[model samples]
Target: MENIVIIGNGIAGVSAARHIRKLSDKRIIIISAETDYFFSRTALMYVYMGHMKFEHIQPYENWFWEKNRIDLVRGYVTQVNHTEKKLLVDNSRTVAYDKLIIATGSKPNKFGWPGQDLHGVQGLYSKQDLDLLEVHAPNKEVCKRAVIVGGGLIGIELAEMLRSRDIPVTFLVREKSFWDGVLPQGESQMINEHILEHHIDLKLETNLVEIIADENGRAKAVTTDKGETIACNLVGLTAGVSPNIDFLKDSGIALGRGVKVNRFLETNIEDIYAIGDCAEQHEAIGSRRPIEAVWYTGRMMGETVAQTICGNKLEYKPGHWFNSAKFLDIEYQTYGWVFTARSKKESEAHFHWRHPQEKVCVTIAYHNETRQFLGINTFGIRMRHEIFDRWLTESRSVDHVMEFLKDANFDPEFYENYEKDIISKFNSDMGTTLAVKNKSWKRIFKTA
Candidate 1:
């Protein structure tokens, strides 16, 4: 049989392994330093919030890997020797392979701030982070306050987790509005207000200066660029993550900010491929960034690479960007390319609608001249992903999308109906009369 070695036990690496086994009985060995088995990274927050246990996040039982003839190794890959077709495990052990797949994933970014390496200061990414949180901030008595340094998705997740335990969180966002870079101004401001409502000390436009350490070498507080020091037991650096490619620095693989790969996810070296968060496309696909750290994209790249490795030669075509995330109590979903107001193209125009008292809102982007539907962002409203995906593929007009909006919603029985109110507002603003049509399954789930 042929030997196939994969680095990292993330979703991307494991998905590739499972699919490859279905195609061939090749020798597959997956190595990871993070955990013994793959667990859903997104559910890390839930685990911290006590909603689920760590083992519960795992998709398969413990015996699944052994039963499938997949070998698992627990070791940190310190170096990769591509020419020798071997990997340096834990600086001493060497593992050889016929074909290599690099899915090393991402690491939390650190900008070399003072006292960053101190105890009680860490980033929430891996299982180790969760374990450290248990040691450092198990309860409000042990951790009175947590100062999170970034306003991204991870930061919000940490805030919610800590707040669940009655531990106050002080969030620092460099942006004027929370997640304004991705969300439109309307939605961003709504989230800012929502954060405040949660009793979180949301400090907008604030930057972390340094983490103050106690006499015992643990984080005591953090000073900001504003020269103010707020006392806290934990400092969470949730600024963002970067490619965990530090091990490949001297490995001779082509690298930009991440491992450079072609459309097929093939790196510069033959018989070696890269995928998931660490794989940076040579040329960006559509409006997506060269490196997408989203979970679904990673799984897509994994399946795509497995096909090529199995002689099917498939290209990774992640059609129509879509993602969903939760902001405290609100649920947010975005499909296609709904750029922020500042980032909107010259031809783009947005139609925004907000419920009077509730946090529900939706923004529809369309071409100003053509009225062709561009994209949509929904908050506190559940919209069917497949419905928007089909509409984007069909190149439906904005008017058509509005008329059939009822069909696109995921829940029609209980959720508040806003199609009539939204259409009325759109007509008043755009001076065009358009009424919503009754939802039909044929239109929502149309095959064509």
Candidate 2:
């Protein structure tokens, strides 16, 4: 049996272990600094709102590993010796492996400004961070206000959680709008409006100068770049995170913004693999550059590594990037060249606009040259938006979808034809299966 060791018990590590176990009777050992089994890191925000218990957010029970006969070692990984294939745990102990997997994840990026280490300043990352917030969980009498220092996904989620608990929240954004890097200026404005309408104060184009700590060593206020100061009890920083690569400094492995890997998910060192937040992956569309830090990407990489180890003939080829999130009763999404839509070519550059209400709007765009559905943004839509599924498979020119909408009529047959072409294209290109279930095409199709 092969001796295999995996560091970190996150989604990537767990998925790798599960998939690899099915391929061979390897002596698989998983080492985790934390004790919890696989759990939904994405669901941490719900815990703050008291909508879910910690137990409810857990993805798997203890029995999951016992059934697989995989060895679980609970210890902090302090160091790594790639040449010797050994890992140091808890200062004195070491474990050797024939194959090593590093899925250690990432640590929250500190603002690097002065007074960041103050008692009342926090970064929302792990369950530990959530636990700390729970201890100081907002109350009108105790903790009335909080300053969320970033306006991205985690920051937005935390703002909602704080509001649900009746805690007044203010968001400080470095860009001109919320999610500036993720969405277009117009889409960002729409979200910013919705955020403001919900009673959340937003400070745009602002930078954090320093956190002001009170005499008791707790954050009492925060100073911004514009020389404005706001009194607050808690300060949450969701700036971003860096890969957990301190242990690998002496390991002779290559490094980039994250651990470097090729199409096979194998690192520079022999018999060693990296995945999840710690490992960067090739993007599905356009440049195919490495993308770090997303739950779905981590899970996909984990499975791909396992298949490679199992001698399965498969190569990981990411396609049709999908991005979606729901916030404050509004669904928002952006995918593909939504970021790259500034090029010259108005007609060739696909962009459509729709305003459902005064404060609600929809924007969809595509890269006609690539026949790639670029992105869609919808605000205040009553129904769920699953345009991502269509965007993933559809090859229709963005103009077609736009033209269909201009007729002010619902032609299920046209949509059905478009969907069929997309399914066929995906199947031919990626060897993906796309069978309609239970003859369900009738439901979405218009019979002539």
Candidate 3:
């Protein structure tokens, strides 16, 4: 039997192992130094916020791996020798493999800032980071103030986690508006207001110059580009993450920003493939970034690579784009193409609607010339992914989408519907009064 070894027991590596096990009886082993068992990385914030325990984030029971004939190794792979088909574990042990998969995932980015390696300065990416957070910022007394230096998803998550324990958080965002690089002006402005509403010191257009350390070598304060210094005990460097492939620097594998892989997830070295956050496609795929750190894309790459490893080669094809995240009190969801102001190259028209008394709004993007629906961004509202996916696939027009918007709504029946109001606004803005067709009770109540 061929021996298969997968490094990094994240969603990608675990998914590949499980799929391969279903297809073949090959000996499979997953190696990781992060944790003994694979846990949901996204749910780490919930664990800190008292919403869930550490064990609750794990997808499978403790004995699931042993019962399923999948072996687990708790070690770190320091280097890979492609010619020998062996991996050096902790520079001591050698693990040979008939085939190998590299899914080491991502690590928090550090830009060589002064005092960046301080004890209380950390990034929220791995289990070890969470453990460090517990030590440094267990409560308000321990953590006087937390200064998060970014406005991305992870940055906000860290701010929320600290705030959950009544810890003061001073959020520093480089962008003029909150997440303006990704979200539209209206949506981004709404989030900016919402963040301030939560009593967070939301600092916009602020850049961290350096972190000042205390006598104990922990974070003491942060100096900004504007020469402003904020005193804080915890400094969260949640700027972004890069592919965790530092160990592979001398491993003879081709690497760009991440490990270079073909569409089939095969690397330059034969029989040794890469996937997930560590795998970068030789060419960009549509609008997808070269390094997509999203969890679902990692799982997709895992499943795709497994087929090829199982003698059923298949190209990785991550279909339509869709993602959701929470911003303070608002829940946001977006599907298809919804570029920010900076990236709005093509001529597009936007129809935006905001509720009078609620932090709810939806923005519809459409082609200015063709009037074809491009995408929709909804905040404080739940929309079915499948519905937008189908609409985007069918190339539905903006008018058609608005007219039948109620049909795609996934909110509870008792929840107030905003379709009529949205349609009225759209018609009023476009100088036309288009009536929406009445839907049967069955269609209206149908699940997405």
TM-score for every candidate vs. truth?
0.98, 0.84, 0.96
lDDT of each: 0.92, 0.73, 0.89
Candidate 1, run of 10 with poorest lDDT: 439-448
For candidate 1, write residues 378-445 as lDDT tens digits. 99889888889888998999988887787787886534377778889999988988876666646544
List the candidate numbers ranked by lDDT, top first.
Answer: 1, 3, 2
Q: All candidates: CA RMSD in angstroms?
A: 1.1, 7.0, 1.9
Those runs of model 1 whose alpha carbons end farther than 4 Å from true positions after fitting are none
Off by over 4 Å in 3: 412-415, 436-448
Candidate 2 residues 127-246, lDDT tens each? Answer: 888877866555756676899998788888888888888889989999877887766667777788889999999999999999998899988899999999998888998887789887
Q: Give the CA lDDT, 0 to 100, for residue 398 in model 3.
A: 92
Better of 2 and 3 by lDDT: 3
- Candidate 3, residues 13-59: lDDT per residue as tens digits? 99999999999999999999999999999999999999999999999
Q: What's the residue-level lDDT of 428 in candidate 1?
A: 91
Which candidate number has the best TM-score?
Answer: 1
Model 2 C-alpha lDDT versus the unseen true structure: 0.73
